[model samples]
Target: MKQTVEPVLQDKFERRFLYLRLSITDVCNFKCNYCLPDGYRPNGTKNSSFLQLDEIQRVVSAFAHCGTNKVRITGGEPSLRKDFTEIIASVAQTQGIEKVATTTNGYRMAEHVAQWRDAGLTHINVSVDSLDANQFNAITGQDRFKQVMSGIDRAFEVGFKQVKVNTVLMKDLNDYSLPQFLDWIKHRPIQLRFIELMQTGEMDDLFARHHVSGVSIRNRLIAQGWLLKSRQANDGPAQVYYHPDYLGEIGLIMPYEKGFCTSCNRLRVSAMGKLHLCLFGEGGLDLRHLLTNDDDQPALIEFIQQQLETKKVSHFLDQGNSGATPHLASIGG
Candidate 1:
């Protein structure tokens, strides 16, 4: 990929867009309540729906040209992609790109952990809601807790230094399991994040039943003697903190409690090639046609820049709506 020092992608809010969350496939292996509560069916087989390797590389190049240094490869479950390691290598090697990461459920990761680490995968964020086998099954609608834990261990063993655990702390569901989560991270250099539940799908009742506030989590951590302080790094929407007692720090992502709209700097590209400015946005600019039908790089940059002007100040989901325009399953969380 040829490198060009394009101007940094800045939105009207003066938020510099240096991070890109690129979804390679929307289809997943497990169904979580926060996402596809009912199970998922791929719109097309691997032969047709998923973005081709070349297509993915071009998107990375384009975003890198627009000053996106960090790229997080997300999916319904990213490891489900057959050439996942290759995708990591491609993005990690792109000119001007600094870091490449993946967010996965960890079911299919054990087999390829070493390969991915060797292929330049910078970080891994595993979505684990519970440590109990039964609760895990109930949450994900899958019997893969052992597999997931094994994959997480493998990632750490393979020397992926920044392996973090993303635990969605629900109220009645997994709220009682915070101790279990803390015990699991003991003496391990794995940071844990309690992601507050957000209204993103057709499940208002679910949120009412299981949504846990970040304040509750903070109090729990303080009771455990964790010295928590607000972090300033705008790496993402995570409200980070530090605890000297633990090997790794703790974080709280309050998408509903604390909105990060003023400093929202990330843009999303769905697997089908649509550029989304907000996670809860309804529509996006189609870049597939530009990639396949045209060869004008400047035109592609201009198109994305123009669309960035229309980004919503904050997500519509935050407003007490039943759901957002695009369901969670369609985009990578």
Candidate 2:
């Protein structure tokens, strides 16, 4: 039975979504101060398992049918899943999905990155908060900075033209070390991304104490002769900049900035199979039931389109509302 194809996913604000950030697990090994500080805790429930392979495949296929060209496999740490490579392959082989990316802590990258690339992983983003080893340890509660760095080198060796590094800029922390970050990326093909600290439901105190805007960073880049690059149709929200002297690039993700959501082009799906219209929006629509079989693809597509219509034009982050999001790890930040 041929299912009727729906129009591309778009919201009332006239923004078209061409990317999906799909979380494969809520379990993260790192205890980042802003996110899972104490470590990942299971609720000890029988139904706490993440979506299975088949479920992810069916849901991704439905999304592909609705015009999602890129699928970024995210997680508390997506690489933690044993079947992560399989997940990448499935998403890459899905019709209409041109890109298969993943975000990780780089714990296993040094060991398994080649296998990941061979399994159809198109792009990789690693979290590297600080250039100083000790500061990196303090921020992420891990002393594997050397290993993570090695993983990045391996990524390049394995033929990744450019790797992205996500650094959450926070006051009195790595915020002052932008110069060091710049020097490190000057000769490498790394896209050093600086993400603004966001306030979540569980970290009000942390947010108040460490939140730093990306405006200053953007200004600094412009003053330093970094040219703002135009965004592609399937690109994420990061405002990318390139310079003539550097082999690398820089990206700024300022969620609190005015008109930030005006160019939003991605949607999130939790590891437990809930579709989130916005990263900081309210509750998600449960789609796990609809992801069970291939026969459910049509209904799943319909439900997604219907729910997408209710998406808010912008998030309430400016109003201090990180609705239903306890922290970044829960839904794959």
Candidate 3:
């Protein structure tokens, strides 16, 4: 008998990806300016491209089989799906999938957090551009402040170990809201993160106009005598810090920060099931057909491994070159 060979999610550079971003749907309820604009529809056949329950199980289990232990369920808003609870539970139950996480706008999370937590959802990242109601609405193009806040509070109340708040800093837009953000996190258990907006899609112009460096924000935190903490083991990429007197920690994810690309361990799967090795690279391996069919699972596994060799040296955004922005709702950034 021939000895079996184990499969892995490794790139040419020898970095292994234990995490997988699984975007289940291209639908969303909120229209954040920096993300999904007021009127952006992700291109795809809603019925065909969007993974059905069985397809989701097959694809997730395949990746999990190849050493992907973590999965983050994302979307224009993952909560938009009628089968949100079922999806989470199913992904969580996949063999070899040790962790299941989700990123959302918190619009529908609060009321359903208990169900999510019960379904083995281990982590959550909520995008909160601003704490002020008016600014929040201005950024998201929706008046859903209370619902989001309620959801955040409910996550904590339900015993989530990690509840992060993501803030995308813009130059003239919500920069002034940082002080209030700090004040809010000073007493809450929720960790706050400052994300440097990446120039994707319609966000290129917005980034050029409103982008601010996360390094500057971290510097401000240090200036206030906050101490830098050693990196903790986690699937997501964010440099973390702490303040001795505060209840929450602070994190920064600057996509263009120096030395950011040398260690890459992420592979993105679009809502339509195309595998993108790099966030800004062109062309992708379409997994939709492979997913819909049942016979070539082993072949599909080998195809993914082969494609890993084609991972780019780095993202185009690092060179200050912005390409066509994929609608984030569709891509699940």
Question: Which model scores highest in lDDT?
Answer: 2
Q: RMSD, each candidate, Å?
A: 3.0, 1.9, 1.8
Candidate 2 Cα outliers beyond 4 Å, as residue runs: 1-6, 44-48
Tens digits of lDDT, candidate 2, 33-96: 9899999987464334798999999978888888999999998898888888899989989989
lDDT of 1 at 266: 84
Count of backbone clashes, every candidate in sequence: 1, 0, 2
Better of 1 and 2 by lDDT: 2
What shift in Å separates residue 142 of candidate 1 from its native position after superposition?
1.1
Query: Whole-model Cα lDDT per candidate?
Result: 0.80, 0.90, 0.82
> In candidate 1, which residue ranges exceed 4 Å CA deviation?
1-5, 43-47, 228-234, 322-326
| Residues forming the 10-long window of minimal summed lDDT in candidate 3 | 39-48
Candidate No. with top TM-score: 2
The candidates, ranked best first by lDDT, are 2, 3, 1
TM-score per candidate, in order?
0.92, 0.97, 0.94
User: Residue by residue across 32-146, what tens digits does model 3's lDDT show?
Assistant: 8887776557464654657788878878888888888888999878888888899999999988888899999898887899999999899999999998899899999999999
Deviating ranges (above 4 Å) for candidate 3: 1-3, 42-44, 232-234, 293-295
